[model samples]
Target: MKVKFYATFREMVGRKEVEVHGVKTVGELIDYLAEHYSPDIKRELLETPRVGPNKPIDGMILVNGHNVLHLKGLDTELKEEDEVHIFPPAGGG
Candidate 1:
């Protein structure tokens, strides 16, 4: 699957996009990414006080322009051509 990182997430991963194999679901993919990147990324992406240490924030992951929450949550299935975008919430006033 092709996973794309945007904004602060891109900086955190040090890459705009990455091709990973054996990723079937959103949750599985997130787990893989957290394990592959630096400890800082793992901490920031995975360690949320609200969701505990394993659940990533719902608003952080967008699957093909649609938030995973509206889809199948973390179990959202992904295909080879599907685009998964990871981004932090944007805020400006």
Candidate 2:
């Protein structure tokens, strides 16, 4: 499977895409990334270690073009060739 990052997430991994295996759910993928890449990514993406709702990070986490928040959240399932995209929270009015 391929996990693609955008905005700040892209900066965290220092790349736009990464290949991963042994993950079947979006939550698992996040766990795997936290272990191998940076734990901070997990914190930010998961919205943990946060303060109120004004944090600098709060983005859309998508799986195969579907918003995880509307699905099963981090429990969203994944299959082979599935693509994950993390986009920084939108701004401006």
After superposition, candidate 2 runs with Cα above 4 Å error: 49-57, 91-93
lDDT per residue for candidate 1 within 1-93, as digits (tens), equals 788888877887899999988889887888788889645544555565645434446237777888886788778998777888887655578
RMSD of each: 3.1, 3.6
* TM-score, per-candidate, Cα-based: 0.76, 0.81
Q: Alpha-carbon error at 10 in model 1, in Å?
A: 0.9
lDDT by residue (tens digit), candidate 2, 1-93: 888988787888889999998898887888898898878787876664542444423577778898887788767889988988888666679
Leading candidate by lDDT: 2
Give the clashing pairs for model 1. Answer: none
Task: Give the range of the ten consecutive residues with the poorest summed lDDT in model 2.
Answer: 48-57
Q: What lDDT score belongs to each candidate, Candidate 1 first?
A: 0.74, 0.79
